[model samples]
Target: MDVRELRNCFGRFATGVTVVTWKTDDHEYNGITVNSFTSVSLDPALVLVSIDKKAKACQALENRPFVVNILASNQEPIAWQFAGRPQEKLTLEWEETEVGPKIAGAIATIECIPWNAYEGGDHILFVGEIKAFSYNDKDALMFFKGKFINN
Candidate 1:
C-alpha cells in the first residue's frame, strides 16, 4: 500500500495530542507535538512516546529526562507551536519539575526518566520510567485524519 494510504488507515484510530518536553544539556527547553504517547506498564509506571528520527526531540532525549504533557482541549495553539507551525501571539507558562519542564494547563503531565531507546522504522521509540505524574479533569485535544479535534 502507498504510504499515504497506510497513514490514513492508521489515522482511523484517533489519538490524544501530547507535547514531549525535554531539557537540553545546555539547559534549553525543547519539545515536539506527538500523538504516539502510550502507557506501557502500570506495575512499573512506564510510558512510551515515539518520535520521528529526524525530530530534534529525538536527539535531545538521549540520556535526558522528559515530560509528556497531555494537551488540554483549549491548548491547540501550544500544540501547533511545538509542531513547527508558530501561532501568532502565542504565549506560554511553564513549571519546573524534578524530571523536566512541563507546559502548564495540560490535562495531564507525566514526568519520566529515559529508560530505553529502540530503533523503529522511521522513528525512535522511547520508553520512560515514570517518576511522577499529575492530572486534572479536563477535556483533551485529539488528532484524527490529519486534523486537530478537541473533545
Candidate 2:
C-alpha cells in the first residue's frame, strides 16, 4: 500500500482549515495550520485537533491550552504563514484569549483547555475542553484534494 496514495485518499474529504495556536511560557505565540480539527462531544463541550509528531506544535501544546482559529475565506495568507511558507511581510491582528492568541478576523475561535491525548500513527490526537467560543458571519476556508477553497 502506498502511503502517499492513502494520504491523497484521505484528502478527498473536504475539511475546514484552522490555525491551532498556543502561547509559550516565554510569551511567544505559535501556530500551525491544520485541517484535522473536529467536534468530539457536546455535554463536555469537547473538540480535538491532530498534530504531526514531528511538528513543533506537537510539543508546544502538551498539557497547555490552545485556540482553534477557524479560518475565513479571505485568510489564505495567514494559513500559508502558519503552514510553513511564511510571507516576508505578514501582518496579523491578534485577539488575546485566556488560552492563547487567535487571528482577530477568523470565522470562529474556540478556546480550549487541554483534556486528553492519544497516539495515532504519526499524529497525536489532542482533545480540549471548550472553555470559550466566538464566531462571525463569514465564509469559511476549506481544504479539499490538497487545495484551498472558499466555502
Per-model TM-score, in order, reads 0.97, 0.97
> lDDT tens digits, residues 87-143, model 2?
878898898987789888999999999999999999999999999999989999999
Q: For residues 5-102, could you state the per-residue lDDT of candidate 1 as single tens digits? A: 99999999999999999888788888999999899999899999999999877888887899999999999999999999998998889999978899
RMSD of each: 0.8, 0.9
Q: What TM-score quantifies how close candidate 2 is to the native fold?
A: 0.97
RMSD of 1: 0.8
Off by over 4 Å in 2: none
In model 1, the worst 10-residue window by lDDT is 55-64
lDDT of 2 at 134: 96
User: How many pairs of residues collide in model 1?
Assistant: 0
> How many angstroms is residue 38 displaced in model 1 relative to the true structure, after the best TM-score fit?
0.7
